[model samples]
Target: MATVSEVGELLIQKQQTITSAESLTAGLFASTLAEVSGISAALKGAFVTYSPEMKEALIGVPHILIQRHGVVSAQVAEAMARGAKYQTKADWAVSFTGVAGPDELEGQPAGTVFIAIIDDHDEVHIAQGHFAGNRQVVRQQSVQQALDELTNLLSKN
Candidate 1:
């Protein structure tokens, strides 16, 4: 995984800001970014929507989306990224939604994760992954993946 400082430096150089809407990983993605010195300049904010209601109310993840795709789908992840960008007015946004558990959720097995990144132009990129681990490991891996995905996308931009 790239160091948080490296991600921070890249964002700073690009004059771009990022926010996260996290579920299974909670706020780990945001916390990781904030750990880097000078990240505040390009780290806009974060929303830890660990529940369906919070996702709906805070990030505008429509009830229909969650109902249609469940909380752990790529659609929810994309909605979250776009919603975070709109809510925080950041140049970039990333979102993670998944079943990180000792058990399955919405009929999906544990480690079923989806991540999405939305850029300033509203272009979105999403990835779906299945990991192998315990709950904590799954969550940690999700966070790392979210950061890595953002780093890759920003680098390409």
Candidate 2:
């Protein structure tokens, strides 16, 4: 898997922009990219939508979709990616939504996460991960997972 810095460098190399819609990992994915020098060329902006309401309000993720799939499901993750991509007009958009805590959410155990990536063609790719760790570790892993997925996608085309 590629590191966050590698992902940032790839984005700059491709001249591709990216945005994020974060829930479980908060804004960690974007912040990690920000740590890379000159990442501003490809890093667009991010929405820290920790709540379902904000997910709907800010990105137009339908409430019915969330109600049906739960906040941590793959469907919500894809919607988040598509919405973020549309809103930001970025070449790529990554979304993180999950349970990362000592408590379960919607029957999902802690460390259960759903990540989605939307490419420039409007194609969506989703992944569900079960990471094992504490809350902070889970969050960090989720961000890394997102970066890895984006890096792989970038490498493809």
Candidate 3:
């Protein structure tokens, strides 16, 4: 697995721009990449869409999609990724939507996460994770998992 800095370096090497639409992890995924020096060359701005309305308003996630699949579903995750990529015109877009809590959401247990990545070719990859941890831990784990997935995707390209 690649570290966050390595991922940033990879993005810079490829001259690929990245943007994110975050739910559970808020802006952590973008912030993590921002830690690398010169990351701004490939790190575009991100959307911290914690609410459904913001997801729709900011990222252009369809309201019907959210109502039908729920915010945490893979469909919504993919939509968020697609929206972010389209909105920012970035070569890559990563989205995080999850239940990182001490309580259940829409009958799903805590730590239930859906991550989606939109690659340069407009291919969408989604991952569902059932993590075991406290609220903060779950959020952190989601961010790490996102970076790991992005690394894997970039490596294959």
- Per-candidate Cα lDDT values, in order, are 0.89, 0.92, 0.92
Worst 10 residues of 1 by lDDT: 145-154
- Provide the TM-score for each candidate, comma-separated: 0.96, 0.97, 0.98
Candidate 1 residue lDDT tens string, 23-49: 999898899888888898999899999
The reply for model 1, stretches above 4 Å from the true place, is none
User: lDDT tens string, model 2, 13-67?
Assistant: 9899999999998899899899999999998899999999999999989999999
Estimate candidate 3's RMSD in Å: 0.8
Per-residue lDDT value at 47 in model 2: 95
lDDT, candidate 3, at 33 = 87
Ranking by TM-score: 3, 2, 1
Name the lDDT of candidate 3: 0.92
Question: Residue by residue across 86-154, what tens digits does model 3's lDDT show?
Answer: 889999999999999899887889999999999999988999999998988998899888889988989
Off by over 4 Å in 2: none
